[model samples]
Target: MRKADRPLVLDVVGDRVTVEHGADVDVTATGRAALVAQYSRGNVMSRSLLELVRQLDDGGYRCVVVSTCESPEPLVWPGELPAATVVLRRPNLGYDFGSWAVALDRYPAVAALPRVILTNDSMAGPFAPIAPLLEAFDTGHTDVWSLTDSYQLGRHIQSFFVGFRDGVLAEPPFRTFFRKVRVEKEKMDVVHRYEVGLTRTCFGGGYSMSTQFRSNDLGVGAENPTLAGWQQLLAVGFPFVKRTLINDPSTAPGAENAAQVVRRRFGVELSDWL
Candidate 1:
């Protein structure tokens, strides 16, 4: 990692860093990969998170998890992650985007994979097999695939769950984008600069994109579909629900029914994820 690329921690935690090395799986041989960014205040892995990784691995993705926690020590593993899953621990600093930037830098091999999925703990479930759909989408018509697209800020692939195909990661602009990613103090600033900026970069580089749920089909105006249109998304067999919708029901209208609705629809108890 370059000195400049190293994350600049602004907190009083000093420069404490922990890098738990894992057996690096050659992504080139794996054919499919996932970079999952995670953050836990107590350094404990949640069941929902464990399920996410397991599902990805079951779908043939070599997963690399970059976790950020208050403590410098590694995250508490649930003993469920595949043996090949690489876990890296870092001080909570630049949010998910920051953690992802660190992972990309640490494992350049992920960039070479023919298909790669970038996701985070901000959402819940693969309640269904999504890898086949992603593989289907990677046939070259789309350079990027996302579970859902949003229009709150602009038309961009929602960063929480997205896939990159056909060497989009190898593009010079794509690499430069991650290289230039910095720690943004405000949450919205990170969303604007990185989340939204990512799709814009792809567009500039002439990369095509697709989404499972279209914003127009879900919601309108500047509302987030995963929040405002979650029920509709779920009704359409969308396998995941955003954490914001469940963590604080008041954050989104009708989210108060998440537990009941999810249990009835997907037959998976929401309390399990909570």
Candidate 2:
């Protein structure tokens, strides 16, 4: 495998966490929010992630960026970070699931808030305005929602961009699921047990769930809709192209042209990430 395709192995120690407050982070800001779980080896924040953060900020959500990285190095905030947002640095353990679990535990009060978006830096672009999507999530009747759904290994909302409203957030099953989340070394284990598992937990708890982009609606067949039908997704204003498509286009046979397609059509440059 090429270097970029290698699985990341961080210096993980069991559940050890440390916190840092950005110079101007709204330490007092609390309420309806978005928990953006991020992992960056070079400590550089991507422009796409930054754009997504700005959109959430504009949408009136408190942004809590959780960077799951090697421990002990102080997190240096890029001046580009919004002043209102805060940063939480922890040891990389359970991927995005672990980061979200830690962030959710840190801010217990967020559960009571009307809406909470659990997202991460797994994809690129907000090439389009996210206002419409956020509006649908807020007003939609579903207890849990996501940008898209996939039927890959069993139906589940793609974990990269899931939303939790009041009902699901308050459910015991929701809290219990996170409380029981363990650090898994294998990425697919994290997916099956946490990513897909969260969706199962929500349904088992009797919570209504929906997605802005349904798997069937895409009319595409693949384990991952984002990777298989990326062009179709973008054509529908999906707002993001899976980052893996750029990192290793061969992961999806026809997606090798994604970098150029995104640049030419959406005017979003993903070449830097490649």
TM-score of each: 0.89, 0.88
Question: Candidate 1: global Cα-lDDT?
Answer: 0.77
lDDT (tens digit, per residue) of candidate 1 on 1-274? 4536544433222344445645565545677888888876776777778888887787788888878766665567665568778787776778887777777776787786888888898877656666565655566468888878888887788899888886678679888888777666678978888899999998899888888788888755578988888888888878878888788888888998888888888788887774
User: Which segments of candidate 1 are over 4 A away from where they belong?
Assistant: 1-17
Q: What is the C-alpha lDDT of each candidate?
A: 0.77, 0.78
Q: List the residue pairs that clash in candidate 1.
A: none
Tens digits of lDDT, candidate 2, 1-274: 3435433323233345555655455432655689899887766667778888889988888888888756356655434767688788877777887787777787777766788898988888788889999999989988899999898889999999988887467568988887677767688988888888988998788888899988787776656889887888888879888988777878775787887888888776776532
How many residue pairs collide in each prediction?
Answer: 0, 0
